[model samples]
Target: MKFLIIRFSSIGDIVLTTPVIRCLKEQVKDATVHFLTKKNYCGLVENNPHVDKVIVLNESWELMIHLLQNEDYDYIIDLHHNLRTWKVKRALHGVKSFSFNKLNIQKWLLTALKMNRLPDVHIVDRYLETIKSFGVVNDGKVLDYFIPQKDLITKDDIPLSHSFGYVGIVIGAALNTKKLPVHKLKELCDKINFPIILLGGKEDKIVGDEIAAVNEIKIYNSCGKFNLNESADLVRNANLIITHDTGLMHIAAAFKKKIISVWGNTVPEFGMSEYFGKDQVSSFKFQVSGLRCRPCSKIGYKQCPKKHFKCMELQNVEMMAVKTIELIK
Candidate 1:
């Protein structure tokens, strides 16, 4: 069977789909798995051993359609479940297609009413459900990330002291509201006894610098200095990771590193937390939290609706720092 799986952009969401791809290829007999994603995200899955082929959409849906229609795939797995995937499905008439339930209504209730009716299942598990008809089952593995050898950052490149141990701190999120404020990050770093390595893309370079500036402890600013795969190597080698609910957080999960995931506008109840990992920890949720505007959105915004921005502003950074210290020891 030839199967084509679809998920467009973003690092974490695309990473979460890896388990489904692996299961379909390894568990099913005579299965050849192909992936469809944005042109830029091809790197996320291109190095993956399980996927036989990767089809990237270069901002032209018609071009993608033309290429896919020629393949005449046996099955189409719509993991993204967005409008574009719907169009792809419509065009591939008569192709056996299965789409994962996005559970948007459940997300709405949780975000709108602060009620937690959503299932306690990770999005990866839900993605696996799409392949049940093919008699494929999850191997209880979370997700997989493959980094090319050339992209790997060696210990020689890092400071001699940090070459032995350092914490990976992800300082960037897609939205500003989801990030821990700069001052709070400074506090978290101040409390940590060990060396720290701040991780993020070019957009986060400024925030990373600010956090590093306030700290007396040794910290390396790796934001924008390394490519995504190179950054993954840093996460893979870290003693522990302190991160926001972002792509690198998911990457940390892929490495099974000890994670300290901070939350803000989005809650873990949305079922997008680190999956199938050992020694994972979260700082965003608390029963003592008596705030009505906890989860303002299924995703997040540029800034909090309430000017106070207490969701991230009030995070227990000291306690998280203590946890990071303990994990490293």
Candidate 2:
């Protein structure tokens, strides 16, 4: 049977879907798997060993739908159950499809009413559950991130000070409230005893510079200097990763790197966390507890809605640094 798995965008969410891809490919006899994602994120799955073909959604939905129609897939696994995926399933006419429950209502209750109705299951497990009818199991495989040879970094690529090893700190997040403030990041950098590499995109270059400015010898700002895969290469080579809830966190899980995941606006109860399948991995989460207004959004906001920003403002940097040191040791 031919399966077209649909997850349109974003780095982490796409990475989380790898287990389903692997199970669908390996367990099912004579099964072919194709992935649909935005053109920009094609690199995330283009090098994946499980995906037979990656159908990129260029700016043209009509063109993409035209292409999907021809594939004549036997089943559609809709990991991204947004309007776009619904439209794609509709456009396919009669192909049997299974969509993972997004639990938006549960998310809304958690964010609005501060109620915890979400299942105990992680998003990765929920993703695996979508294929239970196909008799495919988790297979105890964690997430997959394949770095191409050209994107791989050598010792020469990093600073001489970090030639031995460095902590990979993901300094950027999709939203402002989800990020550790500049002061907090600077504090974390100062407190960490190990060599540090600040990681992010072009948008974070200024903040990276600010954090690395304190001690150029101790902290090296590599944000905006490398592409996505290259950044993943850095995470792959790191001794551990310090990050907000972002794509690199999942990538770090893919590499099974020790992680200090700092939580802010979004809580881990929403089911996104460092998942290493059945493999044992050392991961620590830091979040200020006892805030009534915590988890203000399932995603995040430009600025703190409460404005006190107490959720992030109250985090214990010294303890987080100590934990990082302990994990590294």
Candidate 3:
């Protein structure tokens, strides 16, 4: 069987689809898996053993469609059920395609009306539902993130202070609404007794610097210093991870790292929390409950929809630091 699994952008969502790829390849007879994703995310699956071919979505839509038509895949599993994915399905009209349920309505109820109508299942389980027809069952494994040998960080790459072991603090999220304020981050850093390494993309360097300034010797700002896979390497080597609701949190789950994920405008009840499959790694969620405007948005915004920003502002950073200390021991 020839399968084309499509999950186009973003780090965490793409990482969540790994089990589907693995199950299809392992359980099915003569299965060949081809993954389709945006060019920026091709690296995430390029090293995946289960993926036979990785098709990149670039600027040329016609060319991308032409390439897909030629592959003649027997099945199309659409994990990202968006308009673009719908167009891809339309382009390959004759092929049998199954889409993952996005549950947008359920999410709207939770975020807008504060109703608990969403299912109790995790997003990974829902992604697996799309491949049920093929009898592909999840193999009870954690998410996969394969770092290329060239992108691997050496001991010399990180500070000597962190060589022994350090707590990785992911100081950035996709939006400001999903992250702690710069002052709050600094306060948390000041309280952590253990050595800390702040992780994020280049966009987060300035804020990471502000947080690390709390104690330059104890906190190493690694935000702008590394690429995605290199950052994953840092997460892999960490003693524990303290993160916002972002991609690196999911990557830490892939590495089975002990995680304390801090939530802001978004809540873990959205079902995108750190997953361990069946692993016994410790996981913690820190979110302010009882606020009607807690989960203000399903995704997030540049700034708080409400000017107060209590979802993050009300968080007890001191308590979180205490938890971090206990977990490290």
Candidate 4:
């Protein structure tokens, strides 16, 4: 069976859909799994062994549609049930497709009125639901992130301070409100006694440099220095990871690294947590509870919708660092 699984963009969301891809391929006989994603995120799924082919959606939608039309897939699993995915499903008319419920209304109600009507399920489980009719079930496996041999960073590539083990601190998120303040991160770093590697994209390099300058010997700034796979390689090698609600957090979960994920505008109830199959308890989440304005956005904002920003502001850096130590111990 030739299957076309569509999840357009973004790192974490795409990573969350891996279980569905793996199960559908391994369980269903002769299932040739093809994935559709944005051109930029090609790295995330390109190396996934379960996927037979990765169909990229570049600038030319017409080209993508034309390419997908030739596949003659047996089923279409629409994990990213957005407008573009709807268009893809429409373009491939007559092809049977199953889409996961996005639960937009529940998310909206949570963010709008601070209500808690959302299902108590992880996004990974919800993603798995898309392929339920195929008789594919969760195989008690966690998320998968494969790193190429060429992209692997060895001990020589890292500072001698981190030769034994290091804590990877993912210091950036898609939105500013989803990230911790520079000073707050520095405070957290200051409290952590072990060697720290600040992880992030090129945009976060300046802040990484600023933080690394505090204690150059103990902290190394790898932000902007490595590509996506290389960064994942670092996460794969880390003893633990301290991150915001970002892509690397999901990647760390893939590696089953002890993670202390900080929350800002978004809450973990939206079910995008660090899932390592059933009863995945090693990971911890830190969010300021009892704020009426918590989860102000389903995603996040450039700045807090309400300038108070107490959600992230109130998190105890000391407590999080202490927890990191306990987990690593």
**Residues 100-128 of candidate 3: C-alpha lDDT, one tens digit per residue:** 99999999998889998988899999999
Model 1 accuracy (lDDT, Cα): 0.86
Cα misplacement distance, residue 258 of candidate 3 (Å): 0.3
Candidate 2 has a TM-score of 0.99
List the candidates' TM-scores in order: 0.95, 0.99, 0.98, 0.98
Clashing pairs in 3: none
For candidate 2, write residues 29-70 as lDDT tens digits: 999999999888999999998899999876888988999999
The positional error of residue 250 in candidate 4, measured at the CA in angstroms, is 0.7
TM-score result, candidate 3: 0.98
Worst 10 contiguous positions by lDDT, candidate 3: 131-140
Q: Write the per-residue lDDT of candidate 1 for residues 162-191, one digit (tens) a residue.
A: 898999999999999889888889898888
- How accurate locally is residue 291 in candidate 2, as Cα lDDT from 0 to 100? 96
Look at candidate 4 and tell me the lDDT of residue 40: 89
Q: Estimate, for each residue in 40-108, the C-alpha lDDT of model 4 and write its tens digit.
A: 898999899998999888688888888888989888999989898899999999999999899999999
Candidate 2 whole-model C-alpha lDDT, 0 to 1:
0.94
Could you give the candidate ranking by TM-score, starting with the highest?
2, 3, 4, 1
